[model samples]
Target chain A: MDKKKINCLSSAISIHNLSKTYASGFVALNNIDLEIYHGEIFALLGPNGAGKTTLINIICGIVTPSEGTIMVDGHNTLTAFRAARSRIGLVPQELSTAAFESVLNTVNFSRGLFGKASNPTYIEKILRELSLWDKRHEKIVALSGGMKRRLLIAKALSHEPQILFLDEPSAGVDVKLRRDMWLMVRRLRENGVTIILTTHYIEEAEEMADRIGIINNGEIIMVENKAILMNKLGKKQLALTLQNPLSTLPSELEKFNLSFSDGGKVLIYTYDAQQEQTGIPELLQQLGEHGIDFKDLNTSESSLEDIFVSLVKEK
Target chain B: MNFYAIRAIYIFEMSRTWRTLMQSIASPILSTSLYFVVFGAAIGSRMGEIDGISYGAFIIPGLIMLSLLSESISNAAFGIYFPKFSGTLYEVLSAPISSLEIVMGYVGAAASKSIILGLLILMTAQLFVDYEIMHPLWMITFLILTSITFSLFGFIIGLWADDFQKLQIIPLMVVMPLTFLGGAFYSIDMLPEPWQTLTLFNPVVYLISGFRWSFYGIADVNVAISLGMIFGFMLLCLATIQWIFKTGYRLKT
Candidate 1:
């Protein structure tokens, strides 16, 4: 293959113009176009019912798309389902395990399902990485919720898929499990496996993702590099507690996008973080010229959560 | 043809049977034995004979068919339904195996279990009465064919049904009644003209009659017709499953 062809094929997953309208006439996804580079952690951040699971399920081939096409490792997902699916692993959102089967056997069975030869050593390594090795002989029903979630991850990785999708992996878990999950995700990325996770947790995306995609109402609103998105959309707010309450803003302050609240006891100004200058000095000089004295002032930078809510609310 | 995937699913299903031995194996055996004690010994002694064969020997094949049909459907249905209910079916669906492999694994395991139970009932029936097998090869052929056909039927039911009640409704209300009225314990031949004609419409009658003929060399339907009916039913089940997989019926969307 040529270098360009190899680079295009190197994409772990590529989706184009994908849409799904369920049988009940509910459109779960609009036309979506995305490309996930190999060996990167991509987090799909969306609120509940934003078609996050629907999109993930389509990529994993669990759900069929009504239109468009998807490719995994350059193989068409629908036409070459087996080849495409062999490269992808999905840890579904729900917690489901064979209660009667032992952990070791379940993982082995999952590996065999992908037409992979038995590799006891690889299986052992996965179980150990997930800290499920000690409970290998125990039935899944006997494990706690955290352990069962970990087991789901183990099963997804059983076939050693190049691309792993963790759908809401930390939906309802303790702090310790969340920590362990991210740690394991990092370890996997170090080994060059592409990871795609869907989550409602903004902090998880901020902490783990190289790129973030925000979905809302069956449409992907934005996709950008985490650092770039933060720098571009991050907003800082400056709030001032006035010594004397004002009935209204002065005509001189009309040029500034300022707002008064708490019956004019406080004044607030918002500015973009990525601007060459915040214009804080100009704001203070204008405030002094207007004879608006403040008791105290504070500045705070908005987190990703704030940006996400405003983006969704804008739609 | 992913034999490894098929073997994995088959072994997983078979292991479930061993886990629920009392319910899957023991219960059916004990229930079939009770049928033998009540129908074969108690009723046969007073009923004289059916055709040229003694009443005790005559009901043996019918009784085995009764258990075989019900057990085959219930076993296959439950085997597939539990995975769907528990949400573990996604793992199998997302795997690299084809739909045909999945059906073969599930139906094959269910049919094997039913066949083993059917043969065990045959051995147990011998303790109650001496039954002659006029064509042993035919008997074996019918046993396997009936187990597989009914197992496939059960697999379809498992996919179509959305709840536990739907699962039980067909086998309990429909299958058991048909088995009883299909000449399991008595020949349809003895019934009056209208009743006999009505009984022939019941598909289970063909199965029981064919199996009984294998034992006593007598039949209510021709042996060739019986075999044809079974193959026809098997083909129907296969077609339905193929459509289900292709359309992504309940499993995909």
Candidate 2:
């Protein structure tokens, strides 16, 4: 391949104004624009029925869109499907391996699906990496759920695609396997493979994603760097235990956006993390001046899940 | 579509079907044998010979037709339908393989199973009665043509079916009735004039009659007309299946 082509291949996938609507008049995906940077872990976060799978389907060329265009490594997905699909590997949400087929054959055949010649050494390495070498000759039906999930990953990576799409890779997986998958994903990214993942587990996205895109109602609500999204959208809470239970808040404490909780025994303050001078010290000083005292105090920062819920609810 | 991808899918389908190998290979052969014993031996003994061929040999073509028609449609339809119902079709559709590759892999396996069953019944028939072949080439031609035609029909049925019940509706309701009424057990010539004329509308009659002519060198209907009917049905099936693929009919939604 030419160097220019190789360079183009590194930039993986680009989508512009893509949309999909079923004939039943249900719009599964709205006009969505996204670009997955080369060699990065990009997480698509959405709740159920939010069009994450539909977006993946459009990118993989499995479902045709009603409008717009997608380019995989600069190859038009519609006209140059073979080339576009050859560069991308998709591990679908369903476990679809042939039940009677041996693990080795399943992965080897998936490699051949993209017109790749046999490379037993490469396949062996993939199986070994996925901890499937011991079960190489075992039929898929005999494998456990985690083993089946690993087999799906092995199959996807067999073709050595530049970009890999994992649609909810850990939906039903155990904690051990989920961690193993995260490690494997990190390794793949290190090897210069771009990964686009859709996940309902907020922590999975927070732990593994370099960037996060939130999709809702068939549209992308926001896409931001992990740090930036958290800093810009996250909130902080201050809890103050009072010396005495109060029936009502003091008018002076109104500036702290305070609320009573724990049967009026505690006062809570909510503030944006991105704002300078959260004014906690000033609030406490004012409370002391008012002859009010807190027996205990603590603060809690917002999590990715909180930000995600807020964003979805806002839309 | 690439040949490697086609081969991969073909091997996958064959592996999946291997679990029911006994049922797949034995059911049609056993049914054909029972037809020979009950219809050919018991019934034919009283009816005597027709067109100078023994009653036992007279029903050979019809028995083979029954196996070919039923096995061809069920094998193809069930093979595709199970994958779709089990959600494995999503894996296949998302793979790099094209629609043509998917069809070839499935239809090829279906045709292979139907041909094997057809040959198995033919061999079993040899143990009870011997049948002469006037045109060996035509015998193979009609067998393959019927298998392809019915396999294509089953493919369409598979695509159209959304549930397991719907998948079986075509074979149980349509195929079984058509095979019985299309003169699979007796010659249409034995029927009254009006019934014989109505039997001409049955597509399986043309297939069996053409195949019987290949074996006995004589048929109730003109061999040319039978061949034309079979070919016409094959073309219609091919056009419809191709349209389904092009439009991503049931496969997409």
Chain B TM-score, all predictions listed = 0.98, 0.95
Candidate 2 ranges beyond 4 A from true positions:
A1-11, A96-102, A241-249, A264-266, A295-297
Residues A1-315, candidate 2, lDDT per residue (tens digit)? 122333354456889999899898999998999877788789999999999999998888778889999999899998888888889988888887678778998888788778788799999999999999999999999999889989989988999998999999997899998999999999898888999999999999999998899999999999888877888998999998989988776788777778889899988889887778888779888998988888999899899999999999998
Residue-level lDDT of model 1, residues B21-118, one tens digit each, is: 99998888899889788878888788888788988898899889989999999999998898999999989888888999999899999999999999
Across A142-181, the per-residue lDDT of candidate 1 in tens digits comes to 9999999999999999999989999999988888889889
- Highest-scoring model, TM-score: 1
Evaluate candidate 2 by giving its C-alpha RMSD to the native, one decimal: 3.5
Docking class of 1: high
Ten residues in sequence with the least summed lDDT for candidate 1 chain A: A1-10
Alpha-carbon deviation at B18 in model 2, angstroms: 3.8
- Model 2 clash tally, residue pairs: 0
Number of the top DockQ candidate? 1
Q: What proportion of true contacts does candidate 1 retain? A: 0.78
DockQ of 1: 0.81
In angstroms, the error of model 2 at B192 is 2.1
